[model samples]
Target: MTDGNPDRPVIVLVHGAWHRPSTWDATRAALAGLGYETRIATLPSAGTDPSPTASMYDDAEAIRREVDAVDGPVVVLAHSYGGIPTAQGLTGADNVTQLIFLSAYLLDDGESMYSRHGMDAPADTSGTFPLPENPGLALYHDVPEDVATQAVADLVEQSLLSFTGTVTRAAWHDIPSTYIVSEDDRSIPTALQEVMAAHATTTRRWAGGHSAFLAAPERFAALVDEIIRSR
Candidate 1:
């Protein structure tokens, strides 16, 4: 309960593809306990959005607008490739106090998600893909079993162009940043996650699957609260 500040405003959560806002259920509860407000935003049609940059950026803009409507610095959180959207959307948003990347796809200015993961990166098609159009597509296989099942049920067809689209700028250049790596992530491989978060100004590690907020909500929430307190 280090959240001594009753006016810390809010922590904005941005989820990645193959998942929805409900995916952050566990973590949200944890933040609630520390006297912080939390918002989990779903990318439009994680199943159907076609252009990655536009879809993701637009979604992030909605988040930014929501945050700006508030009264203080926001703790923007991005999970997996959601980092791509958060990065591009908050390029000049001065209200953002910190950026938290949870086992996410963080890129440099002008980099694309596709470039980072590579064209051959594994896709957990168990149900992540095959939207009504690509039936049998595995989008979130690396997520835990329970999460994967729910993800398959509500997942949307993601835009391949999002991955192909490059971020025009690097927003984290100015915002203080922290990265949380799941040591046992199945989808992004902990090794690569470590490499990806190498440049983060601050880093934290937890022993859980990629969706630790769901797999181990309390711990994830505690970390988020801690970040808000420090900032």
Candidate 2:
């Protein structure tokens, strides 16, 4: 693999459940403008399969493949449910220098997303998880109306198994990490975010909803850049 830039580590972006890689278009562009190369990991759990069977472990494998494909050092930024797989994926990955959890679920070993949310795992995990009735309000309330509408339209059904699958290994236990809290997030409660943030090496609070990157890509990218430089 060719090194996009030997000076700066590649930024590997992991999108949340129900979201596609395209959701990071604005943030990726902004990061590129800031002299950082970015790569997006496509989660198998958030695909077009009607009877989705992919679990968080499958997503972890996908993330590992992306990280292993990078030639230089890497910095992974995981959003929402992406953090669970990310924590499991980066195990033994020496090239990954830092992990950034953006309004993400920082789960421990044997902890599933459902368990993290105080919900019991469903007995059957063969189907796709439905999106909220109003994703615009739940996820992108801070974003502009047009952007929120487009985001809602682009959402796909997430795999139920992904949420039910427990974390086998947590990479955050070994790797240095930073957690950025979305203060106004509705999807994941702010208190829950704070609880998860305690596991990170550093924690930051940003004023915005769950999808802050969508609402303010430039500002989000700047904050990311700042975090990267601090390392």
Among these predictions, the greatest TM-score belongs to: 2
**Residue pairs whose backbone atoms clash in candidate 2:** none
Listed in order, each prediction's TM-score against the native is 0.80, 0.96
- Compose the digit string of candidate 1's lDDT tens values, residues 1-231: 224355775788888776677777767778777777776666753644442334556666666676676576788899987888787778778888889999888788867766676664235322233233431223333446776676566655565445555677767888889988887776677888888787678888877666777666777788777776776
TM-score of model 2 (CA atoms) = 0.96
Task: Give the residue spans of candidate 2 off by over 4 A.
Answer: 1-5, 49-51
- Poorest lDDT segment (10 consecutive residues) of candidate 1: 127-136
Whole-model Cα lDDT per candidate?
A: 0.70, 0.91
